[model samples]
Target: MARQTPLNEAHRKLGARMVDFAGWDMPVQYSGIIDEHEAVRTAVGLFDVSHMGEVEFTGPGALETVNALISNDLARIADGQAVYAGLLDERGTFVDDVVAYRFSPERILICVNSSNREKDFAWMKAHAQGVAPVDRSDDYAQIAVQGPKAAGLVQRLTKTDVSKIGTYRFAEGEVAGVPSIISRTGYTGEDGFELYCAAKDAVALWDALLTEGQQDGVKPCGLGARDSLRTEMKYALYGNDIDDQHTALEAGLGWIVKLDKATFIGKEALVAQKAAGVKRKLVGFELTGNGIPRHGYAILKDGARVGEVTSGTKGPSVNKAIGIGYVPAELAAEGSTFDVDIRGRAVPAVVVKTPFYKKP
Candidate 1:
């Protein structure tokens, strides 16, 4: 059976079509994928992202524990800030990509993938050894309000001042009488806010936001649009763009790794890999002739297999087919030519800079 989010009823009330996704009954679309996708790029859209996992780190050694566990430096982030980072095994293989929220001097929250909640928590706990209190918080629900007008939409509904919050910053406040954590961040590369609130108040908060933004063209968005929007920005999707088999060094996420900081879980392995140089690297491409590039399609260089597509889609905003894939570092340069084997036919492709589609 698929788990339903607290806002499932609210989605249904708005005529959203629900589908089983990663063990959760999530909305695939409300009006249509393209419409919702464009609405977000132009106006605003709300997404029920309660399926994401939230892990809490507490105790005196919490900072030290995270510094040793993640590839990013947790000590540098100030309170009420967030950082995009990855958890790697001892061998430098990615365990999961996460966003760490520094809520206070002693409290840090790590948001992870829903499917890997148990495994990620267990891994962190086991690695803690005599570190901090790592508690898995599955009680909170999350929602993303995104697009160009997303900030205004959220500001209108909440009494708290959001004007001062900069990007990647968060504040604890109440929205529509529901206690919430409003973060100035989003996956869609838009000006938006992600609200973390109690599960019991999720439904009411969703309804209140929708009602407040009804006049401003705020539509109930779904996973389909969310995926499309993120793809436009070429944001790495965990299971697709990255995985346990791939190292952060090979995935173009080296910026998140703070090797200069204290010793980390995969520090030794990462240090060796960095010294040796990475082999295969993640790159972006655009379909030249036609046909959308789908995941797992073979990437050919000079009629020989080089790599494969990981994430692809025809971006609604750009009106062009774009994708991310792994290929040899030599062939990863921008403008390098390649071919995608789609249905046994070769389709022309070119290595393009990431963020295939950027919001104007």
Candidate 2:
């Protein structure tokens, strides 16, 4: 049986259509993906992300211990700030993508992908130099309230002065009578907060937000919309656009990899690759002809296979069929054209500027 989140009963009661994802029984959709997708783009949407893993490091060396495992430099950001980074192996390839939150030198938290929870913990344990990591996945439940109107809706329930919490920052306060950590972050390309509260309080927190956000047309979203939203923004999804086989440089995530920082996992490999230059790069493209591109579809150059689609979907917000794929660096330029093998037919595609949907 797939594991269930703390909000599993609440999800079913709200008429969510559940699906197994990353070994968890989670909601795939409620009022359909399109409606939920538009709700987030136009108004507000709530997502149960409790299945995501949270690991912590304590002791004065907490920051130093985790900093050596990830590619980003946490020393660059001040307290109350979080950074999106990659957990890389010695080969400079992704172990997983994660968000590291810095509370202080004595404590830090890492939110990891659900599928990589155990693997990430084990990796950190084996690589840890002094401090040890503790798995806190079951200790908390996370709810993401996102959209243009999302902040207002969340602010209504919390007295934490949400406005003062700028993007990528977080604070601890009471929300709807529940003690919570309100992080101004989200996977959807919108301004919002991801509230982390005691697992026992998830249903109440989820209910309070939905009850209060109804006026703003906040809909309960699920993984389908979540996938589409991230794909539309060209945000790489682990196990899809990124994996151990692909280096961070090839995946276009070099900005998060700071070579000047202290020696960390994968630094040597990345430095070497940077000097040598990456051969293949991930690129975004739009289908010029009919048919929606799907993952694993072959990307062809001059009718010969050259690459494969990593993630693709018919974007609901942009109202266009878009996809991301890996291709030779020579073919990654704007206006470069290729063919995507859809089933068996070849469909013409053209590389375009990424972020298929931008705030208007």
Q: Give the number of the best model, judged by TM-score.
A: 2
Each prediction's TM-score against the native? Answer: 0.97, 0.99
* Stretches of model 2 off by over 4 angstroms after superposition: none
Off by over 4 Å in 1: 131-136
- Please report, as a residue range, the 10-residue window in candidate 2 with the lowest summed lDDT: 154-163
Model 2 Cα lDDT, one tens digit per residue, 87-152? 999999999999999999779999999999999999999999889999999998999999999989
- Cα RMSDs of all predictions? 1.2, 0.6
Q: Taking the candidates one at a time, how many backbone clashes does each contain?
A: 0, 0
lDDT of candidate 1 over 98-154, digit per residue (tens)? 889987756788998887787898998888744554545558999999988888888
Candidate 1 global TM-score: 0.97
Candidate 1: residue 243 Cα off by (Å): 0.2
